[model samples]
Target: MVNDPHALHHRLVDRPRLTGLAFAPDGTRLVASVQTLDDEGTRYVPELWEVDPAGERDARLVTGSRRGDFAPAFAADGTLLFLSDRDPQDPPGPALWALPGNGEADRIAHHPGGLTAFAAASRASTLAWTAALMPGAKDPDTHAALLHERDRARVTAVLYEATPTRADGMDLGPAEPHTFVLRGDAPPVDAGAQGLAGAGDMALSPDGSLVAYTRAPTSTAPDTNVVVIADASTGEERRTFSRPGHQYYVPAFTADGTRLICQRLREETYDSEWQVTLVALDPESGEETDLLPDFDNWPWPGRVLPSPVPGDTTLWFTGDERGHRPVFRRDPDGTVTRLTASGAYTSLCVTPDGTGLYALRSALDSPPRAVRLDAGKPDQEPVLLRAPGDLGPLPGTLTEVRTTGDDGFGLRAWLVVPEDTGPGNPAPLLVEAHGGPQGSWSDWPWQWNPWPFVARGYAVLLPDPALSSGYGQRMQERGRGQYGGRPYRDVIALTDAALARDDLDAGRTALAGWSYGGYLANCAATRTDRFRALVSHAGLWNLEAFEGETDMHTYFREIFGDPRTRRERYEADSPHLDAENLMTPMLIVHSGKDYRVPTSQSMALHHDLRRQGVPAKFLYFPEEGHGIDAPNHLRLVYETALNFLDHHVRGEEWRRPGLL
Candidate 1:
């Protein structure tokens, strides 16, 4: 249906996307990692662009190559440093490159393996990064020797000694990740440690003397996260902040370097509420002071604003509150205030003086766009920086549907109604279940977006039900231990409430979901036949089967107890137990490489449906994981889902996608 390239939301993947924002220390310019579609349209290529944060002039691309550049960072001497491919033959070299304020770019360092990520101190000359290194290798020569030995021995297999053999991005490697430090003209040093949690968890002190990185729990200590502080130059361990049943990561040094700011979330039972808070660590005394204790905020561990001015460490961070993801500023004197009024924000950066703040804000109807915030103003509306990813006028208008749940709890959802929706021409309803049983429909989504459906004359309802986040832990507690009970009630209750609107058609309705949402979609199909058709993407069918083969076996054990011992809870939430009652048409979507939910869940569901004579179809992505990643695959996803809905709900002829 969205085949036309000029269609409103057809080219969302082809647009020039912006991310990885960096502001120069002097606040003269801001650089961002912009991804543009290649000439062949096979993949997106990254390049560095300078955005005018002050909104004075247009943004311009700074560097270019066939292999592309990304992960922009700045050194204290006004030198711009980034990562790019140094060897065209190798492709994606991820070698460190530096470009001075007024000079040609030159390669600084290229590790044996490709670079995973890199970072530079906000106010210091020291630079540090993480890359793949042969396990147990001490130095460059040692790493090279180990690689040679592996090749000589013809060993190409992995022996599992850890619980997480693979994750979303990479496999458990023959060469593990390691850290490196680069300071001035000196040669880079082997830091003898790993950053553990990507570049976000690593921090460099303002003075550039100390580097702080997080150490993931070893086999012996499997439940705690350790924050390690070390000498930046020598890589000597200085101190550690760790405790059992607690996590301490997202490290950031205050402007003075005397104190370190980080987030800590205690390990609680499966039914307990997870309330992560911001804390300031006394690097010398080893004491932590709660920074945002009074506010209802769950600090995002991925990013924290870095203050460039010394002794004046005013921090800005985004937190989940209700449905909006807004920015909150914490002053040195313990005063906490929200700076942005609305919309979800990420990639927060600040000017050198800490007076100007910059971030990208997005909503259900809009895509991510660069914006500036006044640090001095509280609850200020952000000023648009006018960069790329400009979605021209949408084909729909957005509204919210609010009501009370069966338990007398407040419920809400973002309702996207087509522009032509009216009583005489009501739009068909499509209720989309959000992934992450705990995640809310708070931010903009390029993948699970609603505009495309609305453009096709569908009114989309995105509900934050009992298990969703941003509404305090009690909301999740309401559905915890019983995903199919209370959360399903909230979902259907909110859907019925939305159908009561004049612009929506109650007679024609469908359901679609992924991950945990997919599980709930299956539950809805079995419990009630109100939905004309249901689409489940990577959803769990049998909890008992999924608990053993899924990636996070321990996580499931803690959530519902071991199915081998306490099988009651596992059997209670599983959708397969009630599959005999399913009558609605099902479009089961899954991937061959999905370790999170496993492909077996959807396979079993499709088999059961066919044997029972229930109309069903299974769509598979052989190379994709739990979620489809490639832009080409995503286009197929939308097309296939829309085609299925059109046939089953609208009573039109079913037309399969080309790839199908």
Candidate 2:
């Protein structure tokens, strides 16, 4: 399992992804959602599994189907409710299904476009969900009829008066997302969303009296969001949280329903970067309490959960700090403590007794798994519970590299080297850039997992340059409006730090990245010629064009300013403007459906490279989006990208796939 690249590649692309942790009302049952490659090996199949909460035994499968079952939750009666597209032939998006102790799972309710988000109250029988509905449609029956009319009329184009027309890979304003609440056995009632904005990211109070949710496209920009709390049964607004230019969202009610714990982020200005903070707000008085008033790291508000113990206002969440996302516990007295020793965590849930937590953690050498974290024990490793199958050990050893940038800024990177690599046998190196430019490479990402490359004897460097998260806001502010300046230099500095080691071969090196990282890869190719090969997946090339057409124009404007109005940065940083200087062989990967960076960037770069007679290859996925998430396509990606690197950096003959 350690030395075989073929077997590693299979597991890397096909392993089950576990997420969505939830404990039943009585804490007797702990369950999660696991997605694995279906029987046909073509699509993913989601299944509900009840794992031992005590962290002692293997998980037990609760239910499954061909169309898929996901997002497991529990009502107060100990009944399990999940989202499933059980009728595959009908193909209506996931409908709500409930599995009781003595009966089979049955469809409880469904909407026109199926369920998007679902939630169950901790101590009550209230269930709230969100789904798409045609404009002005009040209920599921009305929405279904309207949908049928649209299909009967062959409607394809959407009419939007003010909202955005597109976002990343999604076409906005087709069917509006609406919230619905089911209190008793009657029916789900429409919980009127704030104005015309869509509803999602909701939380129910412990007593199930109030449902708090966030509305998207906040009637202004994508950055601004409003959290609104409404009556669970009547669907009437009770409270709304918002500010002039800042965003307050991801509302989680405390166990006693006295305080609402969520996150707040002041919109970025020209001189400062966005800093996210965890905050607690009084539901009735509207007073605010900064949970992490002086805390530096940005805690993810979506993972916030409150302990159910009486009078305990302690909240648990996770955040990226340095190269890991560790679970954090915030005590009632304002003391914030980290619980897990290492690894990235999500799907956080508090134990019924409020003494511990269950979360999913992932690292470079392992995939996501259920783990137990005891409060106030940051030194102890998370206790892992046995999952379904045997995922053998990976082939590499985790290590770190660090250096000081030319500007005196500290730069860090995660290094994964083959177990056999040492002074006697130095291995080739592949430097991969982290995306976001604003996000850090803190976890094991299945799409860009490095173990397969390590299994093939190539050391992988995951560098967090300027503009990355987890670091203080200043580190990210250093690269704002200057995408090509500090980040590129920081990458080179970190690469030099890695190359200085005895276990790595400096001469055999390759560069790769997607999105912002891809932009940096292009910057490296333009400014330096130290690497043998480079790969850019759905990366930006023309900065002005990308900011003008990308779905996240709102985000780009905050960082680089308006390309039309502020053309200086775009002209200086656009990769296409400097493509003539690229010397190393490059692989350009893009999906036809990728609207985030757009396929046009890759096409234009490929055209430029071919015209200049530069050695390059283009891998395209027509049916996939920005992620290229299809199983077979992912297999091809690993085969093709690694083969390209092996041929150029490892000095191996090109082993192209016979199918291509």
TM-scores of all predicted structures: 0.95, 0.95
User: What is the C-alpha local distance difference test score of candidate 1?
Assistant: 0.79
Stretches of candidate 1 off by over 4 Å are 63-67, 89-92, 148-154, 195-200, 299-302
Quote model 2's TM-score.
Answer: 0.95
List, residue by residue over 190-253, the lDDT tens digit for candidate 2. 7865334454778888899998888765436667777888888888988877765667767788
Candidate 2 global CA lDDT score: 0.80
Clashes of 2: 0
Which residue segments of model 2 deviate by more than 4 Å? Answer: 1-5, 63-67, 88-91, 194-199, 218-222, 267-270, 299-302
For each candidate in the order shown, give its overall lDDT on alpha carbons: 0.79, 0.80
Model 1 residue 573 lDDT score: 85
